[model samples]
Target: MRFTSGTSFDGVREQLFTLGEIPGVLWTPEGAVGTRPLIVMGHGGGRHKKDPDILSRAAHFVTGGGFAVVAVDVPGHGDRPKDVELDRIATENQARVAAGAELAPLIAGFQALVAGRTVPEWRAALDAVQRNGDVGAGPVGYWGVSLGCGLGVPFVAAEPRVRAAVLGLGGALASAADAARITVPVEFLVQWDDERVPREESLALYDAFGSAEKTLHANPGPHGELPAFERDSALRFFSRHLN
Candidate 1:
């Protein structure tokens, strides 16, 4: 792992050498380069913007399997120029409070970020990673938990380059039409006891999958946590399709 530069956050270092203009933490082994399969890790909703768990997970893929990993701060959360605080409140609170006006914009801002995924900035980031030669030549993969899962939906749908994805603790059946657009393999992990996100919603999404390779795994855990076995399953799923 290499330390590139500091980002908007105090201790968060930006790994721009590989991912170019994309704002994220890039991790790869020493003397690695090329258009490797990079795992784009997204964070869950909440105050875990600078969470060590998410960062450590990215490092594991980089060091354990030589996969390039980039974890970006989704709009409305983290160090991005959005309403980091308002996003933490409950949805009901957001609907009731005047301060929640910022929350809607933050959500819209996140959507905009995903919509622009194919634009120059994101492409430049991909180009930078390819230039570094750390990412091996393979189909790219994406992984996210909670809110990151929401973002990854459009990401994989619009970006055909993302051949595989793993989403945990965040999913909703927006509609059959939107779900039909996802053409890649996706492994969705959900806990039966999750209170934050209804299990029915995830089931609806699982039913809406158009990909022949999609899988749904249900385990036991809270909305904010995942069991050890689920984490292993997630990594294995990514490795299988990403490599």
Candidate 2:
């Protein structure tokens, strides 16, 4: 991993890094030293590691919880070279949207394909993060939703370092088996009126998890309208399990 730039603000330190072409951002309390609990954040579709929402949440984890946070751009999603196949899929999805066609099927297939590539990238990034003196090998947590959740389910299943996760806004399509492999404690969110993901699919995804300790918080909203309090709750959840 190579750190290309960094800044300090609001008692938090932020660094831009690259791990073999994967662009990423790391956040920690200013002047932090030694190993600290880590939070690996996954952003939604069309968003990068340094996306605004990711940054806001990272700040909370760093300044409020004193946890180190890392977020990496998924393959074809940020600074990485675009994938021809993903571009083709995106074109098709755009056409489908113009035709008022259902987007779930196309998104399910596309997310499944991308997951095969990103899970390995996340593993490699974590390896590098652990080697960093400040982040070190400590309790790790994951927070992802929508596209993030779709990809993260498989990653958390394949990588054992993540002890807790905040996952939701995703369905079971292309993810049930991977979700079944995840045994870490999870705080799952669901929007009752999510137009993108059918309610049954989201509930089924929650049911698919193999974790003995998992909680579901279903609220009334669209896919992107999770209540703000959920974010606060999620940070507290991470603090409980990771700190």
Score each candidate by Cα lDDT: 0.62, 0.91
User: What is the C-alpha local distance difference test score of candidate 2?
Assistant: 0.91
How does residue 36 of candidate 2 score in lDDT?
94
Can you give the lDDT of residue 154 in candidate 1?
A: 65
What is candidate 1's TM-score against the reference?
0.75
- Report the lDDT tens digits of candidate 2 across residue range 42-95: 899998888887888889889889999999998788787887889988998899
CA error at residue 138 for candidate 2, angstroms: 0.2
Clashing pairs in 2: none
* Highest-lDDT candidate: 2
Please give the lDDT score for candidate 1: 0.62
lDDT of 1 at 122: 40
